[model samples]
Every structure is written in C-alpha cells, then in structure tokens.
Target: MDPNQRPDDERLSAWLDGELDSAATAEVDAWLREHPEDAARVRLWAADRDALRARLAPLADEPVPEAWHTLVRDGGRSAAPAPAPRRGLPLAWAAGLLLAGGVLGGLVGAGVVWNSPELQVALQARGWARPSPLAWTHRAAMAHAVYAPEVRHPVEVNVAQGSAAEQRAQEEHLARWLSKRLDMPVKLFDLRAHGFELVGGRLLPDAAGPSAQLMYQNSGGQRVTVYLRRPEAGADTAFRYQRDGELGLFYWTEDGFGCALVGNLPKERLLALAEAVYKQVEDGIVRTPDGGASRPDSLQPAGGRPAS
Candidate 1:
C-alpha cells in the first residue's frame, strides 16, 4: 500500500517502516490497491528498504563489540555525559588510543576522574570526557542506550511473543512495583504494533537516581527501553531526545513521572511509542492520576507536537 497517500499517510509510512499495526497495515494494503500512485510510492519505499538491508544486514552478525566488556568491568558510567563518551565499554575510538597509551587511561579508568567530589576535579583529568555533556540522570538514560541494543544477552527475559495473559501479568507486576515506588499507577504497552517487543525488564540503582528499564526488540534486532522514575516531589517536564552512538533517546517528565526512550529506531517510531504510552498513561490504562480518564487522544499528540 502507498503510505504517502493514506488519510494518516505519515502514520502509514511509520507503519510500513514496521512501526504500524495489523489493522493499519491492512488498511494501507487496501488503500494501495485503489491508488496506483500510492502503490508506486510504497514500491519505492520497499526498494530503499532492500538497499539498506543489503548494506547493513552484515553488521547484524558482526561481533557484539567485545569492547563492551571494559565498561562493565570497571563499572562504566551511564554512557558518559556531554561531548564525552566515557572511559568504559562505550568509549570513543580516540579514547581507546588513550587507553593504549596507558598514561591517560589509568587515571580515568581508576575512577578518580569522573567521580571526584567536585566537577572541577573530574574535569582536570584528560580522559574524563563524554559523548555529550549530560546530567547524571541523562547518563542513566545513556546506560540503557548502550546495552539495550545487544543481539545477545540484551535482556534478562524477552517476553516478545508471550501470550496475552502473560504479557498482562508482567505489566501488572510492573505497575504494582512502580506504583508503590512513584506513588502512581504504571502501565506497560505491547507496542509490537509499534515495532518493539517486550524483552523483560529490570530495576537498577543510579548514582544520580534509581530507575526502571523495560527492554524491547525490533525486527532489526535494535532494542528500545522505556526508563521510568520519579525525579522529584512533583513536576510536568518537557520531552526531549539525545543521541548517543548511533541511537537516539526521548525523555520527559509528566505529572510527577519521569520517562526516557532509548533506541536506534527512527525518530518517528520512538516518538510514536512515547505518544502511545503517554496516552495509555493519561487514559488510566498505564498510570492514572486521581481523577483523569483515558481517551483516544492519549495515544495521539497534543500542543502541535509532531504527531498531533
């Protein structure tokens, strides 16, 4: 089906990108039959996809970056902050050179650089750097950013194809645990329709903040994570995305809730998942404030946001 000419054509494109569901996919197929021009557009999309697969499909089987070992060994910092890629598993190639030199690497790797009592002390060391200057919380987001993409050992439990009842049960456990911590109802989505399959989840401690990460895998083996927390007493925060390595992150605070989306998926797919989760949350399906009821728009955008 031509994704370019559907009523929600933009959405259709996202879906064809494997971001849509069975319902939308069928609708697109039907539409394409009626609109030959649209069909042509879909054909072009398929060709582009084929070309990309031909190019990148090989990387899928490449070694899963053995360098990831170094990061965990010394307790890597969450992806490292601004402009700095950090000294651990996900360090920049240049940093690897520094590590080889032994002079710059030892001091930073010792944990004296980034863990100083003051920012100045941490900054004094040369190898103490980041891919982006991020707040500690953002670094937490970065941690998820790095490992969630693994093809092997990506998660503890991958519930991607779990039965409906099983999925709901997992979400139920997630909600109860999260609710107790944040004093809010927590929701989990089966966004397979949106191209992410639940890959189980975990709770971790952050030097900056504690967090919950729900991992997911896509057809491309790219993994996405939804990180949640309660940052402070109460606040509604703006949603924002940060890029690390080849992946992008979408994070925001809403009604005392904190969330981050980390993945290599297209910006559109990431945003679509965020919007859907936000909607379910607002609709009382995922999380609920005292009196608010969920609506269809819960999965929709508002305030001229991209998908509105």
Candidate 2:
C-alpha cells in the first residue's frame, strides 16, 4: 500500500469492530503505528462503544417488556381497531409518515428520547451527546489520558530528541505544523517558569476537526498536556474547570481558539499552569523559532478569568 494512501472511516471502524480479515487487520495496525491521530480516533470510538455496551449490559439481561412482546406479536399494529384507512390521503403524507417513523426508530435505538431528561444527562455524563465546546474538552482529556503515561513515545515530534539547536528547530516546526493544521496560533508555552519544560507535541483528532496536544514535563517527571483547537463559532469563551477521576482539566476559549490543560496534578498546581498559559496567550507571546519570544502585532488583548 502507498504510504500516503489512508484508510477511510469505514475501514478503520471495521478494523476496530474486528470485522476485517487478518491481512487487512495487519495493514491497519501498521498504518496506525505511523498515524497517531487516526489511532487516537479509533481508540476513542472503541471507548465509546465499550462504555455504551457496559451501560446497557444489564438491560440486555432484563426480560423484555410485556407491551413490547405484544407489539411484536401483533406485527407492530395497535391493539385498538385500525382506523378506517383514509382513501384521500396524499402520497406525500404517506412519505412524510415513513420518514418520521424512520427518524423515531433511530432515536429509540440510540437510547434518546426528547422527554427523557435523566437519560440525556446520563449520556452526557459519560461524555456522549455533548455540545460542540464541551465535546472537544472531553476529547482533550481523553488525549491526555492516552498519551501522558508513555515513557518513550509520548509525542510524535520529540523536541528533546536532538542537540540544542536541533531541539529549537523541532520546537519551531511543532509550533508551525500544529498552527497550520489547527488554523490557529500554536505557542510552545514557556512553562519552565512554573517548573515544566516542553517535551514536544502531536496532532490529534477533535469532534469537529483536528486538534493539537503539547506535552510538558517537570523535573519530577510529572507531565501535563495542553490541547489546542480552533473555536467553533459562538463557543463560550469563559474559563472552566472539570475533574475526570484523577485528572484535573482547565479549559477555556480565547481569541478564536479553544485551549485545555489536562494533568493528574492537584487542582491548584494545574490552575497555576493554566493561568501561565492564559497569560502568555492573552499577551500574544509567540515562542520564536530561535528559542525566543515575539508578540505579533496582529494579536490583540483579550480578557477572561478562570471560573470559580
């Protein structure tokens, strides 16, 4: 297979579901080894599938409702006498009814009901059916969990891979490549001021599009990740914090960009780091290619405060 030829979503999904033959599986495995973004997306899909299955597993063991059995036995006809067919009903009305039935069936199969607030909350709590802004924040957290623990291959582009000059060049390239792909400014945030140094970054997939994750490590080997993505139109720009088990996340939207910092650090420590990032971004401080900082004139000040 050509290196540049990528598998489509159906192929990847098939690979995830174990629907592919051994040869095709091997090919997908090899391709995933070279493409972290696609691997991440597939992993997320698997996680969702597993979570959904686990959530609904008990229901599978429960006896079917009597009403459902009756409905099935009746071939889905109501117990009440079928109203006399209206002979004058238009074909368009029949088509519309078919479309509505199809849509309703899909919603039911997916466990969604317009009036089921509790069910909707349950789904959102498991990181499903979130609005655009919250959805990407969840992805940021997932990316951090997936990559932050790796010892040797945490990032696709390792800034610490070479000499001083080469490392600087790598940092520049990481910033540039991510910025280009994200269509937003990507800053190699100077976290050394807070005891963390850049370890490089990688591109990841977001719900809407591409996203980037920059990893940083402290002297104690503790790592945190900064996730960046272009903001969806009308996304809320307020600073917010969320906790997912042991991970603490600080996320916000600023200057047409969405940023989230995720780590296993204490809330205070993570907030300090998030504040540092916020300050640098608000000041428009872009880390230069030659290991320096420059504020582009195009950038203007933006105001926001962390949510209490």
Candidate 3:
C-alpha cells in the first residue's frame, strides 16, 4: 500500500483493530499522522470501542446460558427463552446478538447499533435499551471530563471574554448559534444565584445529531457544565442522577429537550445548581438584549413575577 494513498473506511477500521499487515499498518499510520481530522475521528472510535469493552468485560468469562444454547440449536423457532438466570447473561446475550447481526469491527467503527426485535427485547429486559438521547448523556459526561480541567481555551465560545457589553453579546450569540445548530431553543441559564455564571458553550456531536455544552464557573474557580440537545421522539423523560468517582451528574428530559449538568462538586451542591437550572428553564428565562434575564411574552403569565 502506498503511504501517500488515502485509505478507505475498511482499511482504516482494519488498522484500528490491528488486523492490517505491517506494510498496510505503516501506510495507515503515516496517513493518520498527516491528517489530524482523520486522526481525531479514529481516536473517538477507539474511545467508543474501549468503553464498550469495559462495559461488557465482566460477562466474558461467564458461562453461555441454556436459553442461548436452545436458541442456537432450535434456529428461530424457539420461544424467547427465559431471561438467563444469571447476573451477566443479559450483557452476554446482548454481546452475542450484536456479534451475530454483523461484523463487530464495522459496527463499532460506525458507532451504530444493530437494531432487531430480539435485541431490543433483550436490552429492554435489563433496562439497557434507550434511544440516542440517553446514549449521548454518556458523551456529555465524557465531554465534561475532557474539557473542565483546562486552564485556558476551556470553551469554544468564551462568554467571559472582553468587556461586559462584549460578554453579553457573546452570550446571546452562543444561545442563538446553538439553538440554530440543534434546531431547538437553547437558553443560557442563570446560575449566578447558585454561585456559577456562564463561561460559554460549544457545539458537540451526539448520537443522533449535534448537541451543545455550556460551561460555567464560580467565584472560587470551580467549574460545571450543562449539556443540551433536542430529544428524540419518545425519549425517556425521567430525571436521573449518576456519579462516576467524584463527578456528579443530574440529567433529565423535558418539552422535547434533553439536559445534563456535570460537575465535581458535592452531590448536594450540584443538585442545588441543577434545581436552579431546572427552575429557570421551567420559567423560560432567557438573556435579554439589555443583559438581564426575562421571560418571553408567550411564556410570561398574567401578573407573573419576573425572573430574578
């Protein structure tokens, strides 16, 4: 393979899995070195692959289930066997079903799922099935982990830059630009009451389409991020909280919108901030042209108190 020749998707995927020969590998490696965009995309593929493996690794050593055995032996005629009567069976079955659907390399490389009735059933039985919105919530967490620690260039659009007038202009621009990109109304929530102010936001890739991340900081320099995207039709709307080591997240869906707040603050404090955001969202508070928060005419109730 010529090192200068651009490799196709198949060749790049093979290189990712280490299935390419030394010559092919060298060619692909050289290509990636010269193409930073391709290199970054491959890095995302690697991250997704590692995440999937980590999530399913616990089930690898478990015994194959009797239900799976019966299903394999009886072809497609076997009644959906009982949910495997073991801890790891659900994930194991999921892995098997995914593998049986298509080549694993292609599936992971494309960042997609092999949807089927049986696969859906298996995933739903274990509360593992969800629409793309739920999947991107994990991406929200990853985005926070990657960007929150930066000393500079923490956000793509820095609302904190320049004079107060310039900062306000940036805030409005962030809101309008994200709303346009996501095809949903994006508001810059007022978290100053909870000791956080808008630092800015950036567009992000989601499972379905583009999402947005708004970064905020407190007087003490502690940072938190809010992630927003348009919810898919029939997405789960339940409010959920999750913790990964020291990071705490509060995520929910409402009125065709998905939002997740991620931070390393204590759960109680993070919950307070999340609640503040929820309240502002519920009230339809948006930044006005004069650099103050107010509700739109459609959202303002008769004699309703103005947003603080």
Local error of candidate 1 at residue 118 (angstroms): 16
Task: Choose the strongest candidate by TM-score.
Answer: 2
Worst window of 10 by summed lDDT in candidate 1:
120-129
For each candidate, how many residue pairs have backbone atoms clashing (under 3 Å)? 20, 0, 0
Q: Name the weakest run of 10 consecutive residues (lDDT summed) in model 2.
A: 88-97
Per-residue CA lDDT of model 1 for 1-308, tens digit only, reads: 44555545465455455667888777776776676555545544443333323333333343434345555565775464334435432333333333343323233323343454443232324223334344534554555644453444555444443676675566567656755755544456556657666667766554455567778777877677887776665544766766543556777776556777776678887788877666555544532222233443434332313233
- The residue-level lDDT of candidate 3 at 20 comes to 91
Q: Candidate 3 overall Cα lDDT vs. reference?
A: 0.73
Clash pairs (backbone) in predicted model 3: none
Error of 1 at 14 (Å): 43
Across residues 192-252, which tens digit of lDDT does each residue of candidate 2 receive?
A: 7788888999998887789999999999999999999988889888898987535679999
Model 3, runs deviating above 4 Å: 1-134, 288-291, 298-308
- Which lDDT tens digits does candidate 3 get at residues 1-308? 76667888778888998889998888888898787557666765565555445444444555666776786788846865475365545555667555544355466677554345554455445444343435767778777766776665688899887988898789878888998999888888888778787889999988878999999999999999999988888877777787643467898887658899999888888888887877777776765535468887644321222122
TM-score of 3: 0.56
Alpha-carbon shift of residue 58 in model 1 (angstroms): 25
Full-model lDDT for every candidate:
0.54, 0.73, 0.73
**Residue 266 accuracy (lDDT) in model 1:** 81
Better of 1 and 3 by TM-score: 3
